[model samples]
Target: MSSNKQPVINKFGVISSSYYEKLFKCNGQNLYKSRSGKSKPSYSVTRECILKFNHTENLREKERLKEQLTKNILRCKRRLGLRTLGSGKHVNIPGGWIEATYLAQCKGDIQEEALNVLYDSLDHASFDYCQLPALFFVAESVLYRLCCDAFQKTYLYSVEMKLAKIGYLVFLRLFVFFLHGHLGGFKAHLLRLQQYLNVLSLSEETYYKYPNIFSNVAFILKTSEIIYERVLLSESTFSPNGNTEGYENVYSDMEFQRHLRFNQGGYEVNHLLWHCVAAWSCVQNNSPKLNNVLEHLNFHKTQLQNKCWLDSALALLVLAEAAKLNMVCLKALMDLVRDFILSIMSAQNQEESYKVNDFSWAWNIVYTYVTILAEICLYAATSDLRKTVFIGFCGCKSSQKNISLKDTVSEDEPVLREASVLGLLKYFSSKISENCNQLIWTGYYGLVYNLVRMSWELRGDEEQNGLRNTIWQTLQKTKDHEKDERIRIAVKIAQAELNDPTDPFTSYGTKVPPNVGDETLSKYIGWRIANTLSKLFFPSIDACAVPLKKLSIKQVQRKYPKKKEDPMKKRVLHFTVREHPSKSELSMFPYPDLFTRVDEQLARIVDHHWQEELKIRQKEDAICEAEERKDKELKEKNHFKEIMKKREEKLHKQTKPYELPPRTEVISLESKERNVRKVTDYRFSTKIVQLQTGILKLPPSAIQ
Candidate 1:
């Protein structure tokens, strides 16, 4: 049988090839049949029947049916040893009573047993069968019970479980898909869970009454944390030559395959770490035993540095709630805020990671919130502590940009740099603005406003005037260059605060005000100075002094020409071929006295020009040498082609020919000389020639 063909069942009940293909296309029909044939309906079919019955009737009728179904589910769940109703025990029930009991109990009231059954379905029942309709029935039951009167007491407890179970169900469903290689499904499930949580609001009574449900909330949070951690860890592990050390290195030798296997089958363990903190915070807010909850929160803070990603956001939310409730100590809350800001700064410096694109924007907004909270907290604290906290919070340098004088001088600094500056300004501005408003509301506006009024009155000195001018120029330049609305607003606010006589921080009542004649102008001048100094020292302590020599416009223009037309248009004439001097040419040219004078002058000019040309050529050669050195260093550092020369050398050596011997002649002579003794003449010939009288002497010639 072809592999692609469907399988067929034989008389013996064995699945044949023809039936396999048919079953494959039947949407898990073969598994359903096999399970049913073994004497029980598949969970899927049972769930389907329940769903069909659920939608066929009104709410009261659905509840009646749900009670019956719940009994059957509980029986099946108990048979599988699943925990129900938080009892940590399995309830045994007859199969016949399960469905009928669930429907009867669920009618017009939340059935705790039905909720137990639903929770069990989440835990033990097959998701393919139990997920969708189970969530719908559970949601409907909880929603209805929350509104119903008779079930209020029981409803609260069961509803918490139901909501939590639904959350877990959604999480698990996502987990299953993620494990099954469907990332989109997992994301969709996560989004749905988020939406559900957004709509969910627990009454204070419910929150305190069911604190244990916080565990489920924690589970949801832990799921998101785990997923994010897994992704980070996976990326780190697979990264080429990635440094696996410290906490990250712990997974180096761990067998991911086995871990993946366990996690794959266990989808119920989807705990989102952030959800846990959020739940705990919720409980802490409503719980009467606030001290204990706060203590518990402090303990959880230790885990935050390692799982800082979500914890930071949670901490902010918790602090915001604390502010709203007016439940926490000002000092303690400020400490938390301080620690959070420090952590964020450290993380930004160490990781260069952004939870959002406009980190500066986010930072400023969050800091503004923190400052506002801190201001309120400060007012709640003693005067000494308020000052300390105020200075500490405002004085902390921004991580995005170093506060240095150079940065202030350059208007075109990077966005982060500008953001850092603006962040500081915003912080100070918000503090003063809020304090001013408070003062006004509290009837201390006259005292506070006069203090700021005094600062402006005192700034009539020449040095202060210059400082003011610099500041005004800087602000104008920044206003022109900055594009972000938040930064621009912040800058405008800072500028206004500096100029406003009622600016509480500056205007805090003083002993005396400036002379009336200079008050208005001095205020303007003082603002300019303060603004300049603020920009110069913002985010950093570095101060840059403008160079004195380059300060004047004429000096700058003299140093750098605004136009190069004359120099650029100047042309030089050069001889294309060298002219040779000849005596005939000179005589024919008949040099005149005027020509002689011109020739002498031209000769001097040529000599000077040649010397200058030689000097220029030398400089050009030096520049070329420097450039070559730089290029060589760059290539060596790159390293890719460095081994090519050695490879070529090796190939050449292998292919080289061996050296040959010098040419030689072989001498062969027949038997000779000795034959003369046998009557054969042996001749030894030696010839000497006599030269003519005029010929050169041969060898060492004897006398003729």
Candidate 2:
């Protein structure tokens, strides 16, 4: 090797002379395309090799690697530009992203140069008269990086101008990518871009012309609209007691944000999105026409048959919203929602362990369904109208007071709320009981949310004591074995909420806490932002965040009162009380002779089944014996008939046909004659007797 050349250091600080030769042999674009060697050029490679300049001890090697990385970025950009400007109909999306990654990882002049190359290529290259959507994404990514760089350097003006020139519509397309928490400072750009798009009045044609580009535009618009309404509603009805500092900050932030709010129509992500938008709009206005919208959605609920799970879930979500707004009856919608969820779960119960191609998407659908059911149940459990509706459904002779749909549901006695809460608890329990491998983190999250929220809501109501054990057991199972961090956090939050129902942070993804005193304006704002973001992108771990360690088990225990043993039941107790439930205790309710009861139930069931089997066997045996007896009798009768028939044939063969016919004819003729003679004789005897008597007397002439 020449003296001017130097060996590069690997991430482990080992001198890799071969790797340095390899870097010079091929640039990143070629190396990435052809990776037959052990060291693959991934995003991490660029980060570790060039980004970490201090990895190498040699200054000359460091400078050489930096120059090499810049040249590689330029080469990658050149390749990307060529491909973007190519006349080929189909462009390699992955290849473009690989180059974009290199550019994203590069710094200083190299990053700028790479971004410029992408911009110029995308701006001027419009082969076949239409710009490729792939190329546009590449350019947007580069520009997004540029905006981030500018923001980091406090060049806000340049960042704004760059985004403006790139267009807000383009930023909307790129928004979901940032939602995964990869883009740190660039998320601020989302709100600003939202503001800009909201202010600008884009025509229907402008949005509709490119359906693919503006596919999620309708959702974006509706989301913005709902957030705005919620913000106003929060400000107007702001609570100030719990966490007042957070509340002030949230209120001030929302009040400061004056984004344009309008209901826009274009392509929606799905039919569910459309209905949700319409439902939110009608719900906010308290329009009576929401009934018609609900009817429309119900009419199309049959579409779930042909559609995917997402559509089925979205349809349920719309119905749930309708129920929430009181446009549809809760009782009717609950049955539909419950059945739909069960059906979805049943469909996913394949025996084979198949890897999901789109686990995130599948998980999202399940999560969405679970959350929709949870919200519906929560609303029904809390709302007074729902209580009245439930009373009417149950045929209770309760007064039909006219309560508005928007009325705050007062914490009433358990009778009115028990039905809804019990139903919701049953749903959560059943979902948690499903196969662990099949259940996703989001599903668990929703299930835990419902459990904890219901437990919290039903606290202090003695009627829910039995259900507390069930909820506690489920939380324990989830907490012990949950692999997903998000789900574990949710379970922890639910447990915390169960411990202290007064905690404001217990409400993970919703604004409404079980204890209203703990709720604040900021918490509600957080809920709204988290929820909208979760739906817009996908569910995130932070979306349903609760306070970390602010709650302690000791505190919860302090509030929980010890139960006095029932003297009558204690006589039957054979077990000792422990501080915490054992594994078996958690699996089954820790009650005296619980296992004995379960064993008894199982024994009775087995005995019933065994008796049924015995009866069936006896019936079958009796039927078989009867059939055999009938068959034997039939064979004997046939044998007797055959013998008689043979004898008759022999007799007929021996005698003439006249002799055989005479036997039947003679009997018939003789019997007829004898009967005739008897009738004549009887008449003659009676007449003769009467004549003799008459003759003996004087007047016998008429008889003669």
Candidate 3:
């Protein structure tokens, strides 16, 4: 394994050089670089083209930009070794979108493989928001947008009359997931999908063929679209809907008695369940709509209890947000999570070793549930981020205070911080420390990986709280027993991170302040670790294969600890990262955990220190201001004498000076003072200006 500087624990090994670089050569020049200079990173050109395509308003120019972007994407796909279908008109391929392009896609079986990776990438983004999803979506968006662009440019005729492109199928898959619809900021990703689908819903050609299949897709599509727009509309304002503020019209509600379902089984879209989730997210302490949204949410309380993929995803999202709000929606989530926790406990009770496929049915629901719950626990337990709370509630200071930071617990709570998240950590820890660790490792690798990542991230006195022991035990056991070489390699990387004190990943944009206490420093490191939590969730290649992936870093490789050395003996852990990573993909800072805020206690300490420093500076500045005032008085006396001397010089130069006479510095009293403006400074007032003017007209006797 390479040193911490390189992302050595990569799930998918780095993408290497490819054949597309020569195909997109502009003006017959080398695509790699100018003969005289360095070239742009692979992603740089494609990203620039995407930005241009979106921003350019000119039709011909926009088309040209789209052409260039298409080429860049194709070049990247080939570079990443991803399959591409060139263009449907590429002569070899017949139907559907493939790879990174909208107009043409890689063939079916190959595209299915790519699409799996794409879905995993999408889930990862909604889960942790790492840098890779940004890359993946950039390419994904271009493909979709270009396909939409081709709706006008290319032929829609097909022999079967069923529909030629399968791109809308991709849109259906994403629309079903809500793609961070729980968080409410994933509008950009879904925005293109809705537009394309809306286009198809209206298209005469599309309706003429595949009418039945697409109608089902369109019905759900419009319903989901309205729900997102309603929730997002609340986010757009400082006030609730129908306020006397910006826009008055409330988003019209779409109604469906029962969720629409297909004959293919369990594939259902519940308008009510999803609508409630959206409404609850926008509900605030003083929201005028809060009572109404809650009323609707409770009305659908039965659907919330029912087990479905949509409900499960929405439940997990609410559970996470509940933790942030000190369980604002605890009553609602307790019912959902109670069953979830039991399932996890049940999975553990199994004696025989089972592969993930042993219970393929349950794995789908439980794997995502555990991964996301583990994420909630990790952020809540290790980092000071929980102190920041939700952004929506911040505006209501009185309302914010009503909510507590700690969980509401009984007297006999576990030894950990009564935060339920802490207990969950102990539960995961018990899995490692106890004998049945093998059960979880197979079915829940993401959960195992998240725990180890949490342990490494909680690099302080906090680790002594049972986490340190569990992490060490897991790493040591995996080094010898793990069959998957990737797991073994990953375990070794964890071991290296623990042993190497000089790691670059340790620093998370925080500097150890001068004269900082041990407790404060520990808290500060917890704050710093918040930035790197996303790296632990590395699931293969995140973004599309771009030139940026080919730009590799030279890192110092890691060597295993010696047999003679004490493995437990440790050097101090350091923490921070570049605060402002470059806009380019070459920047090493992971994007997912970038926005974790400072914890309350840490914020208070820094604020206190800042206030004291501000006072001392104020005192020093007072003394300096007095000294400057004395100097100004002395200078003014000398200025009067110099002015008289200048008068003599001006008197002598009046006959010959070529430069224009000095402009009047004084305002004329005869000139009208516009509209009753009052003078705030008496020092600037001229005696020549009479009291009759707006500068506080002086009395007649005072004037005399």
Give the range of the ten consecutive residues with the poorest summed lDDT in model 2. Answer: 517-526
> Model 1 compared with the native: what TM-score?
0.24
Point to the candidate with the largest lDDT.
2
Candidate 1: C-alpha RMSD after superposition: 39.2
Query: Local error of candidate 2 at 156, Å?
Result: 35
Please count the clashing residue pairs in each candidate, in the order shown: 47, 0, 17
Candidate structures ordered by lDDT, highest first: 2, 3, 1
Candidate 2 lDDT over residue span 1-704, tens digit each? 22333324322223243543343222122333332435454333344564465447788987787687666655654444453443343443234434543454444555444444443333323221011233233333433343333334532232223223233223322332222222232333234334334433252344232221122233334334433343323222212111223334323322112111111321123333334434444555576656665565455444443334433444454445545556244544554444444544455664332333222234434444455444554454344544432233443342222111112324442111222333433333333423343333345465565556555555454544444444445455545544555555564544443344354233332333233222100111112322343233221223321211123344567899688887776454456567565777574434435444655687798889999999999999999999999999999999977876786788755443344554888899999999999999999898878777875444669648
lDDT by residue (270-377, candidate 3, tens digit) is: 434444344334432334554465555455544432333444443445444434344344334433444444544455456352243143234334344444444444
Candidate 3 local distance difference test against the native: 0.37
lDDT of 1 by residue, 1-704 (tens): 22442223222212332332232212222322332245332332233344445456587776666665655554555543443322232332222123322332332233444444444434333323212322333332333333333224553333444545445444444333333333322233233334334333333344322222333344445555555344323322211122223423323222111122223122221112222223334433464544543544454543434432333433443344343333343334444434544555545555446444223322322333333333232222244333332333344443223222222444543222112222333332322323222211111111122222223433443423432232333344444543434334443333343343443333333323333222211111112222222222121123321111112344467889776567557787764434655656555433355534555688788889999999999999999999999999998876745455565577654321343432331111123334544443222121222245434455655663
lDDT score, candidate 1:
0.36
Using lDDT as the yardstick, the better of models 1 and 2 is: 2
Q: Which ten residues in a row have the lowest lDDT in candidate 3?
A: 516-525
Give candidate 3's error at residue 534 in angstroms.
26
Off by over 4 Å in 2: 1-269, 279-292, 302-322, 327-336, 349-363, 372-382, 385-421, 424-445, 453-490, 493-704
